[model samples]
Target: MKLNERSVAHYATSDSPADHTGFLRLWGGLGTPPTAGGAGRRCWFVLKGNLLFSFESPEGRAPLSLVVLEGCTVELAEAPVPEEFAFAIRFDAPGVRPYLLAADGPAAQEAWVKVLSRASFSYMRLVVRELESQLRDARQSLALHRRSPWKAGATGRSKPQASEHSSRLENGHSPSKDCSPGGSVEGRGSRLSGWASAEWELPGPASLLLGRGQSPVSPETSCFSTLHDWYGQEILELRRRWLQRAQGGRPARENKDRP
Candidate 1:
């Protein structure tokens, strides 16, 4: 049951009441979830199982139903809408979220929003957790080669590590010492760039740059190399843990392969 004053939206699959229209008629702003809150109206229409979840609300507010389906979209035409009812996936989250598809007034909307918000929150956490798992695996693969270059000598790795991009980093390579042009590598990246960033102290971009005498080349080049090497190690370590976990956290697996 939806409210009379407020219009609820949904994917085509949802069971909208006979009085309510299943087809969406929008006025503006939608496609994907906003990276951050922004101005203007934005909405997300999702199809889950047989239910169509049309998630909307003010952007960036508390009780945020900030998580939803990431999918391809179909746009709709603009129409007259309530000023406060505009969908916001921009800079803000929805207010008192998880508003339902029931036919009721403000109270129903409030209850529905809360219910859905909690569900979305849970999902958001899972995604973050999954990321942690993958990163751990990639980091470990990198470390194995780093510690025993001779064993991994058959595997070729020549390029510097991409600080944030683990997929591109070499998993099979010589040890870190062998790759060194000479000296300590200090890698710095914003701790805030990923799931942990929001919860941790992120180093500035300059942290990725070389500091003091830690230079084998020009300051700019040295900084780049140092950052690269530092991040390279981090990548290895993270992947190492991930791989260990995947293999069931066994010490024996750590010693296997590459030779």
Candidate 2:
């Protein structure tokens, strides 16, 4: 219906009657239909539904009588036309043979062709929009159901008890019931690796006992090694004294000879 107004504005002069039920009358020079001998004279054109109608104006009285065209199809002209006529549009319909109609100007021809073509396709557009709306609603319903929690009581089954973690929190106890003296499973790897890394990074003096560097003989090794060796010798000497006391302080050669 909106296309009717556009067609009238572009193709019709100041005086023309138009509506939705009746055909839209556009004044233009009519070319000869395929059955005609030569180019036709100026006339008025109208399109109602799938039919096209042409009317010739009588000299004194209003135009009457109608030539109806059906299975109507409209298209723009491929080549340029004579100057006497503006740009042309070709109409091919079922009952009638194809004919070339000339508009008053090129702009008018373009508007007539575009508006009519779009009008034909508008119904398909509405159907597509309705389908898209239904599809969107279906997806929203599915997602809402998926995100909602299930109601177990609806199945006539008793509800599950709270997990240990939830029970601990409810009773004001820490939620680490399964944790050992060390830590939780998630943190164990990081904790062990951190302790080993810190142990390796101890001061040079502590490296000797930990055996972190190359060898104990390295000159650049910690000076604490000398103290460590002194303590080692003192420990060996005290052990020898204790063993001698256990043996009643007997001389080694005397004991061997007696045995």
Candidate 3:
């Protein structure tokens, strides 16, 4: 392929549009570097076994290429330029930065393990705690309001004490809709409604962004195989818990609330 003095074109956009992400397969082989030369020019490193890595663009884009660094771990689809991409190249590329350095094998491995473990445990605790607390609160509310707090089954379906300036205009007691996560409610009539409504509200925005801010910048690279087994097991546990939650918190149809 030939650049033929045609400069590489670059598009500047904040978020990538999903459909246009497959621009790498456009090349059959290495094209000439987009840069002519110098301190921050583009160049091609190597291409073999369907691994077409570039040194000028973000795998296959423009506007941010002193040198595009692209590589495909998986061949058929487009290669992924990881978030640590530029950092990896700057250290490994020899010329990107004079003072940059790569760590030894063991150090790099330890760094990656530390980062992945932190993420796994953080998410594990967050998700587990949320579900556990919600279940506890709902159960407690039911226990408290099982029949009637002040009286026995002799009252049958009685309401809690009422007031003229009460939050519950329709019912004789305050509404349990706003009890939130673990706040117990007491009243037989709205017990089911309280739990259903709370669960409905709980799961939607209960998100926990595991690794916030920027991506990990250890400057050291290591293959993830060492932590893969533990990561995989934890992921399976999270998935199983999520599935159970989905079944448990399924929304009720208004029409089906009859019985």
Candidate 4:
């Protein structure tokens, strides 16, 4: 957790490993070819909470790199593992190459997978919650805009005209008449309320980011593209629906199938 900076001498001479109080340490190789020098160099991995950190040795005194296990996709290696990699699991980190980690054995591999899965779920939930909160704020803003007095009108003026019902209320119209005072406001309110209640029923942009058919092993890079596309479409659809309702209290026929 400290992540203190250390000099070369400090790294070479010091061997102060973390207590790993709530950490699970697994011995594994970083990778090969690019990391050939560290290959077979028996590194110590400590997974604490949602983060996984590696050390040069088991004590975890020599800090290597740390990875936040959020937005990462995991999958079994499509290619067969070589003899050296009898227990291997692949992870596709965002904006990075697909790195292969060779676990010590089957037990280690399973443990790593379990921890990573939990981390991924936690991360996803956090992202989705944040997105939902943002969406709620956006809906509130849209409602405010709809209720603005400066909304467009045929009178060529920003100030909106009082509805007949509102004028009736102000002039103390007889309640016995067929048209009740404030009827227009009440009817519009009811319609808007119904629409507001249905807002939550629609799938949010974040929920649609990862398609229903997306594989657990799908690359994060591709998922981003899908998410952007889905998000854009959802925004456009929402704007179009809002415009129609504001214009004539009905959805546009062109986008009838969208919602």
- Superposed Cα deviation of residue 76, candidate 4 (Å): 2.1
Q: Order of all candidates by TM-score, from best down to worst?
A: 4, 2, 1, 3
Candidate 3 residue-wise lDDT at 61: 47
Local distance difference test scores for all models? 0.31, 0.35, 0.28, 0.40
Ranking by lDDT: 4, 2, 1, 3
RMSD of each: 19.4, 40.0, 23.9, 22.4
- Local accuracy of candidate 1 as per-residue lDDT tens digits, 9-94: 32232344321112122333334332333323333434332233444532312221212322211111112433232221211234
Off by over 4 Å in 1: 1-11, 14-115, 118-133, 136-162, 165-259
In lDDT terms, how accurate is model 3? 0.28
Instruction: Estimate the TM-score of every prediction.
Output: 0.21, 0.29, 0.17, 0.34
Error of 4 at 254 (Å): 60
TM-score of 2: 0.29
Between candidates 3 and 4, which one is better according to TM-score?
Answer: 4
Which of the predicted structures, 1 or 2, would earn the higher lDDT when compared with the native? 2
Which regions of candidate 2 fall more than 4 Å away from where they truly are? Answer: 1-39, 57-73, 78-81, 84-96, 119-259
lDDT of 3 by residue, 1-259 (tens): 5542223332222342321111121111223332323122233322221122234445544332222222101101111222111112111333333111122233332232222222222223334444434443454466466442222321322232122113123211112223222333222112212222222233322121223332221111122563365235445654664575567762354224322
